[model samples]
Target: MSTRAPDRFHVSSAVVLCTPGAADRLVETLAEMPNVEVHAAEQGKIIIVIEGKSSGEMGATLAAISSLPDVMAANMVFEHAENLEEGLINGHRTDAA
Candidate 1:
């Protein structure tokens, strides 16, 4: 029997660069997104983390951020995920051992 679950937990980070004087506005816009968290913003660069249930959702979120006004560019810096069920199975085994 298979123990692995099909669902995935996805997390990715991206750096969004805004126009010279648009950093504050871009930060405010990014903060309104439910799945995106702005970690830092300085000058014209903002660091953000995006989380979603699947990779497709993450990609879509990134694309949306890139399209937001005042955003000059958005580039992904990191991506990682794991199957929740699989992680639980392995965790239980370790605990029992």
Candidate 2:
């Protein structure tokens, strides 16, 4: 059986910081995530990517990350997957008149 990775673009939010250092600590806090990808690290800061299915899940994930001492701040870079989704829900026609 082959397993495919989850949608990367659908990434809800990220936990960014200098460094948590302790894998055990990070693991305990992010036990929900079966996997984690570390992008870059400097001095003691690093970027962690989180994949959440919904906004509520995303909020919880961020909260857990924030509780970590290493986390400086976590912010959602993009909202709601994409802008076009927002437009359609608001009743804006994509077909330019």
TM-score for each predicted model, relative to the true structure: 0.83, 0.48
- Taking the tens digit of each residue's C-alpha lDDT, what string does model 2 give over 12-83? 535455355754455445555543455554554445666655566667877767776766666655544543
lDDT of every model, 2 decimals: 0.86, 0.53
Clashing pairs in 2: 17-45, 18-44, 18-45, 19-44
Q: Give Cα distance to truth, residue 50, candidate 2, Å.
A: 1.0
Residue ranges of candidate 2 with Cα displaced over 4 Å? 1-9, 13-15, 19-32, 79-97
- How far out, in Å, is residue 61 in model 2? 0.4
Q: After superposition, how far is residue 2 of candidate 2 from its true place, in Å?
A: 30
lDDT of 2 at 38: 55
Tens digit per residue, CA lDDT, model 1, 1-97: 4555556789999999999999988898999999999999998999999999988899899899989888889999999997655535543433432
